[model samples]
Target: MATASMADKAKAKADTLIDEAEIASSASAGDVQAELENLRRDIAALTQTLASFGSGKIKEAGMRASEIGAEAADASVQYAENARSSFLSAEQDLEAHIRNKPLQAIAIAAGVGFLAALLSRR
Candidate 1:
């Protein structure tokens, strides 16, 4: 009868330990679930922030490209104006030279024409 009582006491202690272990395991699972939820929220916030940052950078790059295009167009216009000015100046100088030496200019033209005809025949 005493041996039976000792075995019963041991069984009761094991049952209490099992119950405590089950309670601890359930509490740990709840804590893990809460941490996972927090992590999901953090990831969502980070993604939104990155998206906003990317859009801002793209907008800034577009504005910079537009500015560069405008600068290039302005430079092209200035270059065209300079070229026109140079062409007009050369034309005026040639006109002045022809006026100052009409006979010499006629001789030079005849020589150029003769040379051109020779080259064409070849």
Candidate 2:
């Protein structure tokens, strides 16, 4: 009787160990699958955020380029106006000098023209 009871107890213990092993393996597999799913979701979110940031930066750069172009055009117009004013002032000064010394201006002009003609023949 003692021998039979000992055998039965050993068999029961073996069965319990097998059940525990199966449960542990299934739980580990399920945990691994859940972790993988979470990783995939995080990667997808990161990709979306990066795409949005890139487009925003591109738009900002385009706006900056436009602003620079407009500033350059305004500066060009200002330079043109300054040059025109300077030319007009020079013309007025020359005209005043010529009127004040008409006889001397005519003699200087005749001499310059004679020189030009002589040089052109060479």
lDDT of each: 0.98, 0.96
Highest TM-score scorer: 1
Model 2 per-residue lDDT tens digits across residues 31-117: 989999999999999999999999999999999999999999999999999999999999999889899999988999999999999
Candidate 1's residue-wise lDDT over 38-86, tens digit each?
A: 9999999999999999999999999999999999999999999999999
Q: Largest lDDT belongs to which candidate?
A: 1
Clashing pairs in 2: none
Q: Estimate each model's TM-score.
A: 0.75, 0.66
What TM-score does candidate 2 reach? 0.66
lDDT of 2: 0.96
Error (Å) of candidate 2 at residue 82 is 0.3
